[model samples]
Target: MQPLVVLISTFTLIFVASYASLQPAETYWNSVLPNTPMPKTIQDRLMSGSVHDWGVSKIHPDICAFYIFFPLCIGSNIKAKDDPRRYIFLTESDLKLGTKKNLYLMKSSNNANFLPQKVDDLDASTSKNLTVAINLLLSHPTSAEAKDMRNTIDMCEAGEDNACATTLEAMLDFTTSRLGNNIDTLISEGDTEVKIQSYSISDLKIMKSKKSIVCHKLTYPYAVYKCHSMSDTRAYKVSMVNANGKKINVGVVCHIDTSRWSPKHLAFEVLNVKPGTIPVCHLVPGDSIAWVPNEL
Candidate 1:
């Protein structure tokens, strides 16, 4: 009994020491946090949870990757007034054209980094606070404690830059908590080996349904995402063939519940509908991620 008690004490001390010593890599902030300040107009809209006129060019590799994987997503070049899919559209293109190789290049470069890193295994390129927060959130805080954490996250989302890291971590934790011990981060890459294991492009329409978090890459220095999950969300895995004949399996999340979404969301403007009137679906872009529960 004395030995067991000593072991427990040692473990607690080690955990506390490690937790207190955690720090982000010197370059983590430079790579993940935004360098140039976001335009006040765009920032204001984001704070209010409205993505209307995001203004950031989708041609940027990170943003462009979404179009490559989720070709159904309305392109930045398309005017909101011209979009025809104002409601839910589940159609998957068998042959995706017009996507550039630069989008693929960006995904290949950053795919590994987009994954959630463990607190003890983190490197200089990852956000330490975010890692720690996820670990804590997953540890089963009281309901009031969780609510307070979410409030802090809301403050962060409302432009409190100091709280952004914590906000992201908490969001990730909540998103992932939907699953048990079965989370997997999927990044689409066009490779022969992957193609062999992927679904035929035609089979995309019939794939089994699942739940997942479609994490969109937000404009940040290293890597930050607006990761969210909805009850009515359906994420599907489907194969897509690009113009170059490269095949890859990608995740597409369709949100059937937009009732709580801000009416001014970009989807509403692009789809020409008011919030909650109908479902909105989009692809899981190459630069982004789909966190799903792995099927046993």
Candidate 2:
């Protein structure tokens, strides 16, 4: 009887161990891993939820190589170097092109930097069509339609509402003529400039004063140091201090425009300065430079 009881216990243990071993292990998701290079399709679905789907799935392998892989290969990469803003922009560009999987990868990565607000800006129902357009723009940045779209953004930034509106109308007209349907207009007149109020950074209290913060002139997109308001610590306004104790006035901090394919700091071009004199300006606060809640 004792021998039989021992035999039964042994069998039960074996069965339980075997069943546990057969179960799948928890999947670990890493967004930066480089594997599974195939473009999105039905067959590629098998590679889903794998660690190897990171760098391999990017639309622009060349850009990804430069921005993501090269640094790691050479061992000169900055730790946690992924820029959420760039990723969001590039991902949106991909979604605009019809790369559904790329968008899904981004959404699934659960990166804090991913901008859901920007994604929500698109029409939810027409995701596939929007992705198609985005893909086209990504492949051919110099395309006439892409150029027009860029110009429209620029015009809107320059306060040319009529011109911007006309360009948007043209885009809608072109899409309607070609596809026999109109796309949800992502860019409109009212969505242009969003003003953020002044706020505190660390221990420093900022207040929006009489001075309007002006965007520094740069060859690429950069952040402008707008003054923060003291009262609420959330209000920000654009301003600039000039030489000869004169305050040079520029318009409100409307839009952040970038000409480069990557992130950079905002810089100023000093005019009317003495040959040996250097003008001084406040650098963007560390907290300010980092991601802030997109209330604006």
Q: Identify the leading candidate in terms of lDDT.
A: 1
For candidate 1, write residues 1-296 as lDDT tens digits. 00000111122333333221343332232243223222221122221111122221111232233422233332246544433222223323322333222112123223212212223123222222433443333344344334433433343354211112212333345544565434555444434332122233533432233566555544321234555553566566556655556665555666767788776565666556777776676545544556666552
Please report, as a residue range, the 10-residue window in candidate 1 with the lowest summed lDDT: 1-10
Off by over 4 Å in 1: 1-176, 186-200, 205-211, 260-278
Worst 10 residues of 2 by lDDT: 215-224
Candidate 2: deviation at residue 113, Å?
24
lDDT of 1 at 190: 35
Assess each prediction's global lDDT (C-alpha) against the native: 0.39, 0.21
**Which pairs of residues collide in model 1?**
25-124, 31-221, 31-222, 32-221, 32-222, 33-221, 86-271
**lDDT assessment of candidate 2:** 0.21
lDDT of 2 by residue, 123-181 (tens): 22222243343333245645543443333233234421111111112222222333233
lDDT of 1: 0.39
